[model samples]
Target: MSSTLLAKPQMRGLLGKRLRFHIFGAFAVSLGVVALYKFGVAEPRKRAYADYYKNFDATKEYEAMKQAGVFHCVRPRE
Candidate 1:
């Protein structure tokens, strides 16, 4: 029984070539996720917050809160 023909086929490349390809692929995927988060999630959230505060009047808000007695002074802890 000759076993020469039953051997697994070998790919033509350095062993490190396959490892490098896999490492680079994983790095690319991670970078893509970070970019997606920056553009898709963080950018929209930042814009929404900016829009919400764009026309805000801090003085008027404070005055209204004061008029409504919303603030109370607390004694310092000994």
Candidate 2:
């Protein structure tokens, strides 16, 4: 391959504009997706968990704590 082909162009215009357009479009789409998930989907799921825990029984609570690796009792002193 010729060194001229690998070298940076002495003149640049259209290529830079096209690259900038694609980059900005991608950033806008990503921001829209994150905003939708935070405002639209997560609120109801959070409420359901809150309601479930509010009515949870001791046996169920103890099971959940065990699954999460949390224990109610402290270890005895050595």
List ranges where model 1 is wrong by over 4 Å: 1-4, 7-15, 74-78
lDDT tens per residue, model 1, 1-78 = 686678866677767888899999999999999999999999999999999899999989887877677877633235
For residues 1-78, what per-residue lDDT tens digits would candidate 2 score against the true structure? 586587666566778988899999999999999989987889878998999888879887767777676864743235
Q: Which candidate number maximizes TM-score?
A: 1
What residue pairs clash in candidate 1, if any at all? none
Q: For each candidate, what TM-score against the reference? A: 0.66, 0.53
How many pairs of residues collide in each model?
0, 0
TM-score of 1: 0.66
Q: Report how far residue 12 has shifted in candidate 2, in Å.
A: 2.8
Best by lDDT: 1
Report, for every candidate in turn, its global Cα lDDT versus the true structure: 0.86, 0.81
